[model samples]
Target: MTDHEDDLGPRVASFRELRGMSLRALAAAAGVSTSFLSQLENGRTNASVASLRKIAGALGVSPAELLDERAAHTRGVLRADRRPRLEGALGVEKFVLSLPPLRNLEVYAGEFAPGASTGANPYTHGNAQEMFVVIEGTVVFELGGERFEMSRDDSIEFLSSVPHRIVNESEAEARVIWINSPPTPDEAHGA
Candidate 1:
């Protein structure tokens, strides 16, 4: 397993404890066996993508939240090398640019390799507003059933509840910024 996978156990334990959830409680909610969760928390086992998703959903957070750790030494600022990040679906690397004390906002900087995508299917979350801005290269933003091809400096906004996904169909890498107001499963779920 990679360092990120190794850290998942501790992050899960921390989040579960913070939420005042017991091992059995979380396992039941996530529909996984207690022994599995225990082993996962103890680093005796690794979690599959499906299991991770279930656990994250049960905890009212995105899988990425459970995988990332704040490594910056300075307060209110995220060092480039220390930024919390998510190795997103299909070669998409998402870095959370907003530091701790998250408040009601969240910002993500993403690098999408050629053919990279948010996921195979669109997804919706939170009840706030969301915006996607392309910094370089080209990307396709699929919102609901519509597809909008965006290039450098182009942007689009919509409710966070709308099913959406970003895709880089170009041969070059695409850099983009995503902004969410009132955050998402984090502050939105009172985390």
Candidate 2:
């Protein structure tokens, strides 16, 4: 077996442990057989992304976490004005937004270029109240049935439980820092 197979096993085991879930119980939740889960945990089988996703969802985790400790850890934080950018879905770019990584919360800075939007789909996250502090320009915040406009230095805090989206209609880029305490909303669920 390749190293990838070995790396995947512990994550499976970790998930089971974190939820205090039995193998049979987790299998039932994931729609997989107990024997299959056992093999996957022991690195005897290759678990597909779909299986991993189901496992993650049932455990209230993001699929990206399946990478776990296998990825290298960065040595230090990226400085202000030097924050690395991660582009998310819907053509949005999320900058570090100038916040350090601490235990209880995660802070992100994002910039939406002119005409960029979070799209029209409405979705709910586990538990998060995203506080947006507009630092650069104006943004139209759409939360559930309400819409609000925020300007420079203006802020809006709301529960992330409902569907929301942001639109930057101006010709200039919209910069904002999003702060979330207890980073993972469904953190009460798993590893």
lDDT of 1 by residue, 63-127 (tens): 88887776211223458898888657868888988653444577889999999898888888887
In model 1, the clashing pairs are none
Model 1, position 166: C-alpha lDDT score: 84
Q: Count the backbone clashes (under 3 Å) in each candidate.
A: 0, 1
Of candidate 2, the 10-residue stretch with the lowest lDDT total is 182-191
Candidate 2 regions with alpha-carbon error over 4 angstroms? 1-77, 97-101, 185-191
Q: What would the per-residue lDDT of candidate 2 be over residues 1-191, giving only the tens digit for each residue?
A: 66656777777777566455688877898898899889988888887889888876665565666556542222234676687676554646786542322334557777788888766664555577668788898989887878888899998887767677788888899887877654644332110
lDDT of each: 0.82, 0.69
Scored by lDDT, the top model is: 1
Candidate 1 residue-wise lDDT at 100: 37
